[model samples]
Target: MFLLIRISQQLINGLSIGSIYALIAIGYSLIYSILMFSNFAHSSFLLMGAYTGFYILILLSSSFPLSLLIAMLGSGILAVLIEKIAYKPIRDRGNPTLYFIIASMGISIFFENFIICTIGPRFRSYPRIMQTTFVELGKLNISVMDIYAAVVAIAFLLMLSYLIEKTKVGIAIRAASFDLEVVGLMGVNTNMLISIVFLIAGILAGLAGEFLGVKYTVYPQLGYITNKAYIAAVFGGLGNLKGAVLGSILLGLLEALITGFLSSAMRDIFVFCLLILVLLIKPSGLMGIQKQDKV
Candidate 1:
């Protein structure tokens, strides 16, 4: 019974953490699918979202839901602006892919430093918006925050799936992923489509930032931890939504198990090892495509 309880506890913990990874991975996958390059600046949007949500809760109201909404909107707008300011000019000039990557990296560094200079390097804990009590199930104690995070993550992913699968804009997004040049040639406003994609990615990033802040604490370097989500994206299959989700959950479970049964310090080593193994065995990722077929 004790062993079973331990296992269940790890599973719940994994699910909670994995859900956040999945959220961030979705954004990464979306941008990579269309842009054909990793936008390191995604870290900026996420960190900004965390700080934005934190201030909203502290200054405006302690309403968690309201903070989430505003954070999502704020980050979404920021993402669009970034695309316009940094990425758009390069794209218009038909510059090499390296320029986009360097720009993103610059943006990331700028945001991190800006936060440090403006807010300092100290960590800020979120307000106790939700009770920390646990709900027991047959000797297993489940955290309420874990359940809430998992539920909200799942709900948002579902909504994203629906938008991608059912809506016209979603169809355009899918088409753009396959061939942005072709989509534009087909009369679709490729620029608008790209902005919308960034918007969706920003919204997901905002949710992830806030949830992560609640689970841990808000800090300038929070974006560094998002590297795990990037790894999850590679593990599941870069540019594949389903794969990103699966990879994140699996990585989360693996991390939880390692922390539960092994040393916490070994957790990161194993994660990178797993990533290496995945790349060696299947570079396309567990759920990613191996051909020109795009998600």
Candidate 2:
């Protein structure tokens, strides 16, 4: 009974954390599908999201839901600005992917340094808006915040899925993911689609950041931890949204099990090892479809 309870507890913890990873990974996959490059600056968006939520809660009110909404909108606008200022010009000039990479890195570094200089390097905790209550099921206890995060994440993901699957804009996004040029040739405005993608990605990043802040604490370097989300993105397949979600949940569960049964110090080593093994075995990822060059 004790062992079962422990396992259940770990599972709950894993799902809670995994939901955040999944959110971030979805954003990563979305951008990677269209841009064909990793946005290292994504962490900066998460940082902004966390700070936005923090200030909204502090200055405006302690309403968790309201703070989350504002954070998402604020981050979405910020992402649009980033795309316009940093990526749009290079993209319009038809620069190489390396340029995009360098620009992304520069943005990431600038935001990290900027936060450190302006916001200070100290960690800040969210006000206790939500009660740290627990729900009991049989012999297992689950945290209220964990349940809230997981449920909200799941709901948002479902909405995103619906948008992608059922909407006209979603169809354009899907087609663009396969081939942006082809999609544009088919009379689709690629720029508008890209903006929509960034907006969605930014919103997800904001939610993930706020949830992470609630679970842990907000700090300037907190976004650095999204390296785990990047790994999750790779594990799921760089361009596959569903795969990102699945991979994140699996990775989260794996981490939870390791932390529960072994030393926390070994968790990261195991994670990287798993990533290496996955790459070696399937470079295209579990659900990733590989394309071939035409002869």
Candidate 3:
């Protein structure tokens, strides 16, 4: 009975945590799709969103959902501006891809340091979260907040998928992802596409941040979780949206199982090992498409 209880707890814990990772991972995947570069600074936006949400929720007398909306918009606008000021110049120079990656790291460092300087180095707890203990089945237990996180994450992804699949903007996005020049020739505003993509990424990061704020506390270094999201995205498939989602779920389940049998301290290490092994065996990821290079 004790073992079963432990397993249940682990599974619940993993799903809840994994849902947050998946939320951020989807942002990582989408930005990669539009920008053709992996952004390190996007991670820092998670920190920004969480901190801002905390202030909005606790200090400003706003509700949780309202706080999330405002925070997401804030982050999204920041992302668009960052793309215009930082990435646009880099893209214009036709420099090597390595340069952009380095710049991304630089941006990440800037945001992180800025947060540290501005907010100090303490964790801030949520002001007014609705906490509940929910029990299900004869021998299972769960939290309402966990269910809320999972549902919100899943719904947002679906909405994104729909936008990408069923809208003109999405088509433009898809075209730009494949070849910006071609899309440009087709009269698509590449600049607009890039801005929108960054905006979308920012919004998703906010979702992750809100959950993290509730699950733990607001910290200036919340970008640390972005690393996990990036890993999950890569593990699933870098540019594949569906792949990133599945990868998050897979990592979540794996972490839960490991934590069940082993120690929580070893959970991340175990998952990283699994990621490495999976990459070694199948680099394309579970649902990623491989592009063919002509000889």
Q: What is the C-alpha lDDT of each candidate?
A: 0.91, 0.90, 0.83
What is the Cα-based TM-score of model 3? 0.94
Superposition TM-score, candidate 1 onto the true structure: 0.96
Task: Give the C-alpha miss distance for residue 201 in model 1, angstroms.
Answer: 0.5
Can you give the TM-score per candidate against the true fold?
0.96, 0.97, 0.94
Deviation from native of the Cα of residue 150 in model 2, angstroms: 0.7
In candidate 3, what are the lDDT values of residues 93-121, reduced to their tens digit? 88877777898899999888887787788
TM-score of 2: 0.97
Q: Model 1: per-residue lDDT, tens digit, 85-136?
A: 9999999999988999999999999999999999999999989866477888
Say which prediction, candidate 2 or candidate 3, comes out ahead on TM-score: 2
Please report the candidate that would top TM-score against the real structure: 2
The residue ranges of model 3 lying beyond 4 angstroms of the native Cα positions read: 1-5, 132-137
Candidates sorted by lDDT, descending order? Answer: 1, 2, 3
| Residue 147, candidate 2: alpha-carbon lDDT | 85
